[model samples]
Each structure stands twice: as structure tokens, then as C-alpha cells.
Target: MTELRIILFLIGVAVLGAIYYFGTRKKVDIEDELDFSEGEEDIVSVRPNDLPRKKSGLTVDEAHQAHEAENVQTQKDKIVTLFLHARDGQQFDWHLIQSAAEQVGLEFGQDNLYYRFKGFGNNKELIFMVANMLKPGIFQPDMRTTGLVLIMTLPGIMPALDMWDTMFPVGERIAEILGGKLTDENHHIFSRQRIASMREEMREFDHKHSIQ
Candidate 1:
């Protein structure tokens, strides 16, 4: 009985030692495989002249301007827009648009197609955008317009939300000055009822996703 006990104890020790050895070996193998997989990527070779080059040698301001140009459409998508429409049979005057924008502290950006404005409010500098409201199906270099639209937007790097108080008054003021009527996305005349509804929507959206 004593001899049998000794033999069983030795067999148990051997089994445990085998398990530990194989476990450690497998762990080392896995780590090595991971390290190999994560090694630096191989560089593809090209002729010296054929190597990819920047489209242009841009200065700092030029580079920043290029970046902004690329993000124009992206920024446009994230905005709250309000339109000011000219009376029937009247198109917005480009010169008037420029003058009104300047009076309201907006600068002439890019082509006369759009105007840019910024102000410090609510602990941040808010960006305001103004652009032409062209007639439907029109895409020309200098297309005639119904009036202009004000877009409360942020840069591509910033978040988008409804900024009612900040934008509504400005739109109203501009419309008043330009002799145009305020309208919504569907051409509904902007009324107090519409403003209240928009306020509620903005409040609900803010609740779900904080603008900051």
C-alpha cells in the first residue's frame, strides 16, 4: 500500500508539470505571433520622380484655407437654416446682400456666393453662414436667386445643434432690412407658432444629445 501511494503521488506531480510546461509554451508562442503580426508594414517602392507629391506647395494660410474648402459641404450638412425670400417677381440684389451682411458684422467669404459671420456667445464663438437661395434647378456661375439663407453651423470638427435665439433674431433682422419675408424649409411663412414648434424640437434634441 505504501509503495502504491508513492507511485500515485509521482504520477500526479508529472501530470501537473506537463500541463504547466505546455501552457507556458503556448502562451509564449501566441505572444510571438502577435508581435510578428504587428511588425512595421513594408514600404512600396517607386521611382524617385514617380513618388507621390502634394498637389501644391501650400503655405500655412493656404493649407488652412484648403482644409476649410474641403470641409465646406460637410459643415453645410450640420446646420439650422432659415431663409429670407424676396417678394413675388423680385430677386435678391447681390450688392444689397453684401451691404446688409457687412452691416450685421458678417465678412465676405469665398465667392460673393456666401458670407461668413462669427460672434462670441454662450461661452463660445458661434459661426454664422449666409448664402444665396437660388431658383430651383439653377446651377450657374452667377445664378439669380429668390433671396438668401442664413445657416447656423459649426465647422466640421464641431458639433451641430439648433441655435434658435442666436440665429432667429439675426435672420429676422436681415429679412427686415432686405425687404424680404422669412420662411422655413417648406416655404411656410415663419410664424410664432412655427417658432414655438421649432423650440420644442430643439429642446428635445438637446435633451437627447447635449450640444457641447
Candidate 2:
């Protein structure tokens, strides 16, 4: 009888151990299934470089051309960058900085905004120099502006700021200065009319792409 009892106790432990092992495996299987399902649904977000920098739907050779296209005027010879947010935009906030620069009469050359940087931040900023040598606290509208409109679909995914994280905090600080709270929930952050127009423009752009 003692021998039988000991055998039964050992069997019970073996059964319990098997059950625990199966339970742990079942939990792991459920987690694997969840991860697979989530992975199928979520599309990976891409960086600018990761995406093919297409022959931009639009391009401008000079800041003056970009400025005139946007209907903004600038007298000061400062480069106006749209940061990483601008896709088709040539010039934005050109007049804002130009106006401020005019106040100080701190004249620079138009050639400055033309050169491409070989060993600087990733966007290889052209418009950034204006914000670099800033006389801070002068243009106190809470941010930098050039009177030029920034044309981009995703404003939040600004990459120009990330590129210049090493040298100084100019791009990020300037972006923060430019952005502000939207008064109306329906109102767009970038531009009121242009934002509304972009939906139609996107459809046309898509249609044109499909035809090709």
C-alpha cells in the first residue's frame, strides 16, 4: 500500500507539470498570433531619404521665383527654408524674416541661400541661415515666419530639425516658434485655403499617376 501511494503521488506531480508546460506554451502561442495580426495591419512609416525624392511635382530655381509664386515680397537677402516640412514649397516666411532683417538693415547676399551644404545637417538646409544669426526676441509673434506658405501634407513629421541636432538647436527652436495652437478644430494648421485645396489636388495627382 505504501509503494502504491508513492507511485500515485509521483504520477500526480508528472501530470501537473505537463499541464503547466502546456499552459505556458498556449499563452506564448496567443502572443505570437497577436503580434502577427498587428504586423500585417501596420504599415511602416518611412523617412524622406527612404522615400524616392521624386522630381518634385514643382521646383523653383531662385528664392525670388519661390517668393513671387507664393505672393510674398522680401527685400532682405536672406535664405528662407521651409524646413523638412516643405515638399513643393519654394519659399515660406521669406517676407517675415526679410521685414525683420530690413528693420536692422543687416543685408546679406542672395547667393548664400543657393549653395548646397556638403557636410551639414541631413536636409542640408538652405533657408536655415536666416534663423541662425537671429537677433532673438525681436520678432515676438511667438515664432519665425517668412510670409511664405509651407506646402506639405505632414507637418508633424519635420525632419530638418532632426538633421541639425548636433550643431545647435536652431531648426527645432525656429519650428516651435512658427507653430501655434489652432483656434478652431476645423481650421488647418498650415493654411486654410491651401489645405482644403490639397484634397482635390491629391486626387488629381493620383489620377495623373495612374494614367502613366
Backbone clashes per model, in order? 0, 9
Q: Which residue segments of model 2 deviate by more than 4 Å?
A: 1-82, 86-91, 99-107, 112-168, 180-212
RMSD of each: 26.9, 29.5
All candidates: TM-score: 0.51, 0.18
> Candidate 2: which pairs clash?
81-127, 92-148, 93-145, 93-146, 93-147, 93-148, 94-146, 95-146, 143-177
TM-score (C-alpha) between model 2 and the true structure: 0.18
What is the alpha-carbon lDDT of model 2 when measured against the actual structure? 0.27
Model 2 lDDT per residue over 1-212, tens place: 32222222222222222222222322233322211111123322222122111212123243234435333312211111232222232223545444434443233333221122224534332222222211110123334322211111111122322222311233233344443221111223436574345345444444554575
Q: Model 1: per-residue lDDT, tens digit, 1-28?
A: 3222222222222222222222232323
Relative to the unseen true structure, what is the C-alpha lDDT of residue 200 in candidate 1, on a scale of 0 to 100?
77
Q: Determine the backbone clash count of candidate 2.
A: 9
